[model samples]
Target: MKDTATPRFRFIDHTSDLGVVLYGKNLEELFQNAALTMLTIMLGDIPELTGEPATINISVSGTDLSDLMVCWLGEILFLSEAEGIAPCTIEIKSVSPTLLEAELRTVSVDPSSIIREIKAVTYHEIKVEKRDDHWEAKVVFDV
Candidate 1:
């Protein structure tokens, strides 16, 4: 497929919250982009997050793709907020509407690098859909 997951995300203004729209060629790319976008929101443009890489194996599931996205991103948040780890990249091993497995390259999350605290990934306005030639996801974060 054409690699359409390149562009990252666009900011969506929310009242007392953070939001974004994510794109990808497929579900794997879409989920990967979602993690990256969440990272950006949490830490800003932290090029230094590329520090020594560590790997994490993850398997998450939900009732559907949208709920699965929430589970996926929720893991990303747990790594960052609870474990103090920041994922720099993701290699999605496999994905279906209800399940996803991936290996993530990670680094320690520096407390000082945090620009915003996302309370949670909200369900409000969350969407994942294939728009003609590519996939699109709209996600809102609770702040």
Candidate 2:
């Protein structure tokens, strides 16, 4: 979402849920883009950095890369719905298969503007892989 331009993330056909295939060049970019994509799905579009931005330092650990991906996006969902903070910019300083550290530029948003309610970042069909030139992740959200 930050590095891969044309299609940051694309929708996948799902009968009963919402899905996206996220793209990036590395694990850090992949996680950063994943957070951006999750925010877009929640807010319909990425909201501009409007006012004074707040920096949020986030660190999450997982059992593996897949679980790390899930935890990464799940934290975004938690921030949006529970904290009333919309992510504007994501800067992941460190990322590994088991640990991720990031800084998010966020702003306060009107909760009513949130059109879609993503209940959770589901594990169904979730994937994170390194391709020949890029990294990709398949994520489905429970709506």
Candidate 3:
């Protein structure tokens, strides 16, 4: 697919919270874009890390794709806060309606690299759907 034709993400602001939502033509793409969106929120702009790459492995299960999306992103957020790392790229190993696994590659964050801290992932206004050939999801992050 053309780069411009690939998945995309957008930010959504609520009364007291901010979040990201994403859409793609496939489940893997959707998850990948969501990871990018989450990283953007944490780093504003994803920094180029040329060395000492760290890999994060995540597996999440839910009853549906929407819940799975939340869990998948939540795992990334959890690792970022707990491990003090910022992911710049993601590779989806597998994805199903109820299960997802991925390898997240990132670099350790410098003390000054943190722009915003995300506290949790929320279920508010979360949605996932298959429209035409595309899959879409909206997720909220608690900052």
Candidate 4:
């Protein structure tokens, strides 16, 4: 089992949409890191929730790891776009190949602070794989 305490991911340049190449020690970490990446891209930094942090629970379903990744990030995108909520921390409690359950620690962001408006998470050029000892995924978002 990999350490669930810290997850990792990085952003990549994309011609049309936002892109990220994520790394994790395992599948659960991959999902958690992907959520962080999505939030960072939206806020243009690692978000810090001020005042009282709001907690929101999220559950997303997919048919496989790839699909689940898209769905997981897509759910976060939806919250930002439709609800004006941005997450500072994402605690993924349970994750499987087809399902994810998480608690999002968030803060309400002013509409203007949404530096990058991501319209949707896409499957274009999406791939999840294991390389050497870690899992990596390439995700693209429609802007």
Best by TM-score: 2
Query: On residues 1-143, what C-alpha lDDT tens digit does candidate 4 reach at each position?
Result: 25555446666888777788988887777788888888777788857868999999989999988999998888888788788888888888998888899998988877788888888889998888887778899999898
- Candidate 3 lDDT at 70 equals 79
Tell me the deviation in Å of residue 74 in model 1: 0.5
Off by over 4 Å in 1: 1-6, 46-52
lDDT of 1 by residue, 15-80 (tens): 788889998887788898899888888888533546579989999999999999998999989889
Comparing 1 and 4 by TM-score, which wins?
A: 1
Lowest lDDT 10-residue stretch of candidate 1: 43-52
Rank by lDDT (best first): 2, 1, 4, 3
Instruction: Show where candidate 4 strays beyond 4 Å.
Output: 1-7, 11-13
Cα error, candidate 2, residue 117 (Å): 0.8
RMSD (Å) of each candidate, 1 decimal: 2.2, 1.8, 2.3, 2.8
Residue-wise lDDT of candidate 2 within 1-143, one digit each (tens)? 34434577899999999999988888888888888888888898887988799999999999999999999889988888988987899899999899999988999878898999999999999899988888999999999
Tell me each candidate's TM-score. 0.90, 0.94, 0.86, 0.87
TM-score of 3: 0.86
Q: On TM-score, who's better, 3 or 4?
A: 4
Tell me the lDDT of model 4 at 22: 89
Clashes of 3: 0
lDDT of 3 at 111: 43
Off by over 4 Å in 3: 1-7
